[model samples]
Target: MSELETLNWQDWDSVLVVVAHPDDAEYGLSAAVKEWTDAGIEVSYLLLTHGEAGIQGLDSAETGPLRAAEQQTACDIVGVNNLTILDHPDSMLVYNLELRKEVAREIRIRKPNAVVLSNFEVEAYGGLNQADHRVAGLAGIDGTRDAANPWAQRELLDEGLQPWITSLIIITGHDEPTHTMDLNPESVAAGVASLEAHKRYLEALPHHPKPVEFIPEVLRTENGFAKTFRVFGV
Candidate 1:
């Protein structure tokens, strides 16, 4: 693995962010995303689920829409206007044929040169990272390749969705990463604002005496300084 020198940032035209739930990109890669967008790159976000399973006291049926709405506001804050949700059920996002096809279709349509997502291999806070996170990450990577291969999924071609292959894949949350992009001050602010937008979701967590503490830990932790990701193929 090699960490390429800081990118030109001005050359990228389009980027696609794929994650398991809402706010995943914002917390994981919004900083780098800001720089890309500022450089005139079009950033599209594809979340596999609406994160309805989040929340400690509210019903998922109710919380899902709320979280999704929050995600919209968060993306807007960070200058990302293109967002899509697969609306898959939370906690049970299966890595099956249907999921892969849908993800592939989106990739084909977006045709982004770069992709960003959370790490699938890292264990969660208690050795239990969200199952959907891992499922989505694996599927997103596979979907990128599947999207570009005509023989991979005939049904997609029949549906008029062409295949697409992204040039780069960046995975956040990995302790040892190949690339670290130093975020600018504007992006750091955007990251904080983005996480704050997830009001309902943050309140749902069991940790912290109050919901206010979530922001500091998230934006100021060891993983907070520079956005790190594994760069495949170099």
Candidate 2:
């Protein structure tokens, strides 16, 4: 087996996690994110949407701001102060050059050594993944390439965004994870708090599980609390 089959990178100073909506990271990755923050690593979250359409029966105009505020609070709980939310239409994301360019631009701006994203599989985590998730995941994967190649996203050059090659990519929710990192109780509790911070969104979600109960279960593994990932470019 290759060494990458058991990968663990501890030298990173900066990381950027890009996601499709609010609470995406908090679903399970927040515990790990909190651990990184505690280690003094710079972690920023770049959301592709405001999650305006996340709430049922609520107008997107209201839902957008509400979700944005909730996501902000969630970030604060996890020690992630730098949050960026794009205005891409909720539930209508497309994997196009426009999306790629936007993600690449953010990569250039953030200049993180590592980029984190979630599963992009058509069917993920025991259900069909959201369209925005697949699109956003592709944006993170391909956008990293676009950001690395000055010739790919030529428009970014005009905007003074330089090419940036991420040293690693960490993809959560892979069927065959390359690595698993243990999490402490403090970090897991922070994750629970972050998820709970989405008060309105969680309430609006149909039959949503309770954060205090749900987050801990999600983080549980055979041995102990942990987060798994499929690492690339390690």
Candidate 3:
């Protein structure tokens, strides 16, 4: 087995999953998340947007709330306790000071040892891997750094959120990956089931790019056995 495939991950105490939409975490990491939670690790979620722009037949006014509620349901299935939605407009998410400060504040509050996000460079998976995804990823990287900078969000510091940093980052859906989480047969099944919870959001309209069969296959091909990530310097 490759080093990433064999490395043990039972020591991590907390994990923060940051993704572009509501069901993104369930689609990619729910199985692994279950493993972490079962191991006593605190698992939290940070969804960058409501995916309001998604869905074909419905208007954004209607689709947004439906998608948001669907995402919340998915989180409940995975045993995620802390849920946060940036609520940024779907297709228009941008990388900026305001967004950066928001993400940084979450980092400071959670202090997760490991962070997970969609691959900024992925080309196959359409929506989750967008300009917004890259923007969110960059914000997360900088936020972890700025979390410790005394000047970066002094107001937050005053509230006692304090400076904190994640020790590692795990990026999904890359052609080449640096690490992998062994799913075991049960975990893999759980992951697949969790993805199924987003049934409505994935099958309804504009967002359902891939059918059911294709979804798992794509996940297995793009993010199976071992996932990939770039570790930022400490």
Candidate 4:
């Protein structure tokens, strides 16, 4: 394990967050995102799915649009510049060349200097991780590299989407994070608000802890609020 250090974003101009579901960003990386956007770095969210399978009792037809709307609302709270939702099946993401290409397309289009992603480990927070998250995270990693290699996705060149090399990839929800970011009260509040935006989804959970409660509890550090992440440098 590497020694934990304060997250470094001194040179980052823009960031792209990739996730499998609607509230994944909120649970995993929202506070850090709040801090980033507050510092004037443009942030964009790329969701592989509309999170149709997130609500237990809700049908996909209803859950899809509902979650999408909530995700956009959440994005607005953090000053995210843009949001793009793809048609990948919820709870069924596959880590294949196709998935990598799709993610690469977004990376190329957005040309973000840094990318934030969900944890891809087989286990996280001391429990088994979901398959979709594992797939999405792996895809985010590969796609970042793919976006930098023109020959990896030749079609992107035809679409006028130039190759982009993301300098950093930040993975949230790891048990042992390599980096940490201090969060001010305002930033933490913004993150809470963003999580609360998913009213329907959160309400549908069996025993969903209120964002205000769990967020602060999880983020509380010795001095103040903070969020940790595992980082990969590209």
- Best by TM-score, which number? 4
Candidate 1 lDDT (Cα, 0 to 1): 0.76
lDDT of each: 0.76, 0.88, 0.71, 0.88
Give the per-residue lDDT digits (tens) of candidate 3, residues 1-234: 344443356888888888777777765578778777877888988988988887777798887788878777777666778889987988788888788788778878888887777667636454445677777777777766677687897788888887886777776665466666655545556666676766667677454444345434544634354323434444
After superposition, the stretches of candidate 3 with alpha carbons farther than 4 Å from their true spots are 1-8, 122-129, 205-233
Models ranked on lDDT: 4, 2, 1, 3
Candidate with the larger lDDT of 2 and 3: 2
* Per-residue lDDT of 40 in model 1: 79
Q: Which residue pairs does candidate 4 place in steric collision? A: none
The digit string of per-residue lDDT tens for model 4 on 55-148 reads 8988999999999999999999989878999899998888899889988999888889888998888878679989998999999999999999
lDDT string for model 1 (21-73, tens) is: 88787654776777777777899999999888777678888988898899999
Q: Write the per-residue lDDT of candidate 2 for residues 1-234, one digit (tens) a residue.
A: 233354454677788999999989988899898998888888999999999989989999999999999999999998897899998998998889988888888889988888999998899989998889899998889999999998998999999998998999889977778787888989999999999999988887668889899889988977779887888893
How many angstroms is residue 43 displaced in model 2 relative to the true structure, after the best TM-score fit? 0.7
Query: Which has the greatest lDDT?
Result: 4
Instruction: Report per-prediction Cα RMSD to one decimal.
Output: 3.2, 2.0, 3.4, 1.3
Model 2 residue runs over 4 Å out of place are 1-7
Question: TM-score: which is higher, 1 or 2?
Answer: 2
